[model samples]
Target: MGCSNNWCELYGSHTSLCGCFVAIVLHGNKYITNHKGQTKPTVLLDCLAQWGIEKIFCIIVDNATANTCALRKFQSSFSLLSNEAFVMDGEFMHIRCAAHITNLIVNDGLAEVDENVSTIRNAVGYVRSSTPRLRSFELWIDSGKLTRGNFPLDVKTRWNSTYLMLSKALEFRLAFDKMEAEDMLYNDYFMEFEGGAQDGGRGHDCYNPEESDGVE
Candidate 1:
C-alpha cells in the first residue's frame, strides 16, 4: 500500500493557556507513498479511523495544489463517515501554512535579485573551497579587522539559508575585496565563470565583492 517515495503526516494538539486540558500527545505520524492530493486523503482517513477520531478542527498544509486537492477529497470522504466530522461544516478546515507562504513570498522576491545572490554564493563557495584559501581569507579578515565567523553556503531551495549566508558574508565584505585584489586564485576563480571578465560576461559583476551588498 506504499510506493518508493516517502511521505510523512504529523498531528499535534493545541490548547489555550487557561485551559485545564494538559499533556496533549501527537496521534498521527505515518509513512506513505506518493503524498499527492489523490493519495493523501486515503492515508489520513485510515489514520483517523485507527485513532477513532471523528471530528477535525482544521488541516494545515502548504500552498501546493496537491494539498488543495487532498483537502477536498478529505472533506468529502470524512463527511460520508459522519455528518459532524469537521467543525463549522469544514468551512474553515483548510488552513494554509503561514511559514510556507512566507517562504514562497521570500523566494519570489529573491528571484528578482538572483544574480546578486548567485555572486555572493559563488564568492562564499570560492573562499571555503579549500583550507589554504580559507586561511588566506582569514588573513585578509584579520588584516581588515573584521569579525571572523564560519562561512555558510546556502541551499538554493531554502531562502532562510540564503539570508543567513548573505548576512554572514556581509560582515567580511572588505576582506572579500582585499582577497579579490591580493589573492590571484580568487581573481582567477571568478575569471572562469561564463567566459572571462569581458563585456557582457557574467563574471563582470559576479567578481565584485560589493555586488551582493547591493541587494536590499
Candidate 2:
C-alpha cells in the first residue's frame, strides 16, 4: 500500500504498520494468490460487494495472466451477483486497461536483448575499473576524443544522478572545461556505471503500459 508524506519511512514496512492505506478497490493492488495460476474472481468481488458497490458500473484491469483470470472470474461472479441480472444482463462487458499491454511487449523484447548483450557489457566493465586508469585516458581524449561543437574530451555520463548534472554542465561549460583542464572531473564510475541510481539513464521499465488484462 502506497502512503502519504512520510512515504520513505513507510516503504518496505509491514502493511499493519502503515498509518493509512488507500484502497482503490477496483484495480489497484495485486494480490498474487497462494494457489498457482488460480486467481479467484471472488477475491475482488467479495471485497467490492462488502464495500457496498452496487449497480456495478465498470471494472478496470491490466494485461497480466493473473489479472485476466481474475477478470473472467469477476465477470462470472458479477453475472451471478443476482440470478435475475445473470439472465438479464448477460452481455456485461469488461474494459481492458491499455496501459498494461505495452508493458508486456516491452518486457518480452528487452528480455530477448539482455540475454544477448550480457557478454559485450561485461567486456566494457573490465576496461573501466580503476579511477586512476580512467584519469590517465583523459590525455588521449585530447587527441582522439569525440567532441561536440564546443571542445573535445567531452564525456557526459549521468552515473545515476538526474539529467540536471548534464543540464548544469551545459549551463556552465566554461567553468567545467577549466576544471577539466585543472585535472578535475575524475571519477571512473561517473564515466561508466551499471545503469543503477548512480547512472541516470532509463535501463528498463520506465514507460507506461497499454494492455488492460490477460486471458487465463
Q: Count the backbone clashes (under 3 Å) in each candidate.
A: 0, 21
Stretches of model 2 off by over 4 angstroms after superposition: 1-32, 35-39, 83-92, 108-216
| Candidate 1 segments whose C-alpha is farther than 4 A from its true place | 1-29, 143-149, 194-216
lDDT of 1 by residue, 16-83 (tens): 11111111222335544565666777766776677566777777776778788888997898899877
Report the error of model 1 at residue 172, Å.
Answer: 0.5
The per-residue C-alpha lDDT of model 2 at residue 14 equals 15
Best by lDDT: 1
Compared with the true structure, what per-residue lDDT tens digits does model 2 show for residues 1-216? 322211212223211111111222223454434322334455545545654443343344544566556656666666666654322253433445544465555445545544322322222232244445344543444434322322212122212122222232333334333433543333233345655534422211121223211110
Lowest summed lDDT over 10 consecutive residues: which window, candidate 1?
A: 15-24
lDDT, each prediction: 0.65, 0.37
